[model samples]
Target: MNSSVEKCHMFHESAVDLLTSIDFCESTLKTSIFFVAFNPIFWNIISRLEYYTHFLTKLTRNPRTGCYVLAVTIFSLGLVRNYFFEQALYKQGVTGVLQNEVAKVLGVALIIIGQVLVLTSMYQLGIIGTYCGDYFGILMKERVSAFPFNICENPMYRGSTLSFLGISLLQGKSAGLLITFFVHMVYEIALKFEEPFTMKIYRNPKKD
Candidate 1:
């Protein structure tokens, strides 16, 4: 009986140790995810504000400079977003939180559809299409009623939002969903601020 008690105590200690290690791992993963997620969101808000202020004005000026600035802004955003995305995946992998075969297929499908919506908008609208046109002051053509534009009122913005969600699901990262939510919020704000101003710009011009 004494021997059995000793063995049971030993097993208990071993189980506690294993659980402790798992807890440590979970803490590290959460911390890592938080750090990676922060930077892109910071830059996105900053750049989006700056970009909107300059977009329309810049558009009316030399398109070369306008394009350059747009490219810089978008590229910067892409890099940061990618890093966050990578970190989300890393955390999920560590936690074994990813979806299995069925989810994998669904995630892939959403990703493709979302990308199509986004890229279609870009292709139909060009650089100005995917970005806030207010910075350069370059109004898009009178109409953008084509491709992805037809599918969603703000295809570029919605597509981007979808892309984030799709990628997150594909990566099996629950944190990715939160990040995507933030992206959508930001884009929605930008859309509300930007779309009317642009419509007015083009609309007034025709009236003149």
Candidate 2:
């Protein structure tokens, strides 16, 4: 259908426009993007190191305590990254098209859906499962296939991407959208390393 084709074309054009309109040189935006890329890399490297060396466990003298410490560190960094993102959004210019009432409603819906997916996944996994306790030789007895996981694989990453996009729309910031796209790209790369390695860990768990 011509109408359907036009809609698809328009959607692509709008995304391109939003991306192109971003101020890439903004310091705050750069910082936010850096953090976006950094978090996953940091965690993956640290988790893998922990898996091989048990440094955190040795340091804490308890597997659970080590995991909790890593979780706290990750959580704190996430908060800092979010704070920087908020600050960057303030510094960036707004997109006129995303300032409309429809955009606001859509943003609200995406945020709600994103939060539901994120929170529910966390609940299903618990703190140990939510974080990389598996790398610490602490893993769930079985796979989790419920709620958000049942609906989608990698719900946390998807939900996080949705949240970033939602907030970008809510703020009408084209820079936010650009940063969010990179956030997603980084996550996808992280997953490439993560999923296979995690599977290997589970398939041939460490022997005591």
TM-score of 1: 0.64
Tens-digit lDDT string for candidate 1 (110-196): 888888887777788776545544334455656868676666687766776777778766765655665677677766665675567
Provide backbone clash counts, one per model.
Answer: 15, 0
Task: List the RMSD of every prediction in angstroms.
Answer: 9.3, 3.0
RMSD of 2: 3.0
Task: State each model's CA lDDT, in order.
Answer: 0.60, 0.90
Model 1 C-alpha RMSD to native: 9.3
TM-score leader: 2
Estimate candidate 2's alpha-carbon lDDT, on a 0 to 1 scale. Answer: 0.90
Which lDDT tens digits does candidate 2 get at residues 1-208? Answer: 9999999999998877776667788888889988999899899999988998999999999999999999999999899889989999998877766878987788888889989999999999999998999998998999999899999999999998999989988888888888889989999999999999999999989843
Which candidate number would show the highest lDDT if scored against the true structure? 2
TM-score of each: 0.64, 0.91
The parts of candidate 2 lying over 4 Å away from their true place are: 1-21
Give per-residue lDDT, candidate 1, residue 89: 51
